[model samples]
Target: MKKQRPPGLIAIVAYKAFVASLLTVTSIALLFALKNHKILENFSESYLLETKLKIIELLLDKFLIVKPKTLLFSGLAAGFYAGLTAVEALGLWYQKGWATILVLVLVGISIPPEIYELFQGLTLLKLAVFIANLAVLWYLLHHLPKHGKAD
Candidate 1:
């Protein structure tokens, strides 16, 4: 059997998806680290009482109140999601097994909650990001090799 090249569209979409996932993972990790380090624990509110700084200080206070275990688990889940996305992208790019199909199913399951968020109030940025993700997932799933191993 001859190895086939993945479709150009699939390559582009998968690479974009890979980058998105990487960014998501990195952002989540950074948030976790910042919360864990308690670097904001001792900022003198009286000295740095500017409105913007106050708002951030208040937000960090709320964030720091969340349970550490919960934060850790959420961070781990985000990492797993990103790792799986990377795998999906690799599979799509290589025209390997059914990774694209798996990713589509995962995305399909995920969209309902996001759609509800959209219905509540959809920002242009949120809509664009969701649409781009859907488009990439669809393109890769659609262009997957017609014949391949069951795995």
Candidate 2:
């Protein structure tokens, strides 16, 4: 008989999958923007005029200043991250030990940078992400010993 996965494990897998999807979309959008920079700028200008939201305006300003090479690099990086996240999700779904370690190490590595960013600017989004990663790390650490022989 096969062992059933715990709900927390399922939640972790789902969260990773969701993050992968978001990253995939972001990668695609950035790539598309790179290809159609002029069109995007025009569209954004019109959209900005219609909305006039300060946050959107600020984001658009930043977007407008980004060079094509930067866009390409960002797009590639996001795509690579998306791929990594998808792998993590798949490995966890199959209850692979390496996947757990991969997630732990990756999440662990990100913590210092996240804290630094928070110190730089304490935004709600940053706080939420930090909290989420911490929760995932805590859950994995607490549950790992019980699972045993991950390999």
Candidate 3:
């Protein structure tokens, strides 16, 4: 019989679930974007609310025009990653060694990109995310059982 995991450990699993949910939503939104490319254009034309057109146009400029194939491929990739994260969450909840390995690898790989982003510009949000990731990586690496169920 296995013992219960600590609150911190469980929190990480919960975080993973939250991330998986977010990615799933993003995937759907991207797929929908393909069909609803000019939703704002259509709405403004019909609703006659074009006073703040400059702001709307500026916001639209930042968004990329995604093709159906691009959205589908991106959605599939996001879904695959979300699935991996969900599985990792489950395994971690059960105190599996392989889960730790997977998390360590994923988080470790993510650190470099995060740091690069920070160098591009420092923001409270980016700093917080980097700190959180670092803390999670540290916690899992140090606390995981030396010999536990894995593979």
Candidate 4:
């Protein structure tokens, strides 16, 4: 008989999968935006004029200045990250030992940068991400030994 996966592990897998899905969408959007830059710019301008929303104006202002090379790089990078995250999710779902280590190392390395970002400018989104990563790290560390014994 197969063992049931722990709820925490399931949650982690779900989280990774969700992140991968979001990144994939973002990657596609960026690439599309890059290809249709002029159309996007015209649409944004008309949308801004119609809505007159400060937030949209602010965001579009910054977005308009992005170079094509930067867009290409950002899209490619996001795609790569999405692929990596999907692999992590699948590996964890199958309870692969190397996946655990991969996650541990990736999450561990991110902590310092997260801290730096928080210190640079604290935000609710950043705080939540930092806490979530910490929780994942703690859960894996706590459960690793038991997980190994099961193998």
lDDT of each: 0.66, 0.89, 0.79, 0.89
| lDDT (Cα, tens digit) per residue for candidate 3, span 1-151 | 9586788888889988888898888878777765676774465454344566766655554444455688778888888888998998898887888888889899999999999999999999899879988998998888877423756
* Model 4 lDDT, full chain set: 0.89
After the best TM-score superposition of candidate 2, give how far the Cα of residue 103 lies from its true spot, in angstroms.
0.4
Return the TM-score for each candidate structure: 0.69, 0.84, 0.80, 0.88
After superposing candidate 1 on the true structure, give the runs of residues whose Cα lies further than 4 Å from its correct spot.
Answer: 1-8, 11-37, 44-52, 144-151
- Please give, for residues 85-142, the per-residue lDDT of candidate 1 as tens digits: 7777677665556765776677778678778889999899679767866776676566
Off by over 4 Å in 4: 43-57, 148-151
* Model 3 spans > 4 angstroms off: 38-49, 52-58, 64-70, 146-148
* Superposed model 2: Cα runs more than 4 Å off: 41-60, 148-150
Tens digits of per-residue lDDT for model 4, 1-151: 9989999999999999999999999999999989998876887778445767777777777888998889999999999999999998998898888889889999999999999999999999999999999999999999986543333
lDDT of 2 by residue, 1-151 (tens): 9888989889889999999999999999999989998876886678555766777767777898999999999999999999999999998888888888889999999999999999999999999989989998999999886543547
What is residue 19's positional error in candidate 1, in angstroms?
4.9
lDDT of 2: 0.89
Model 2 superposed RMSD (Cα): 3.1
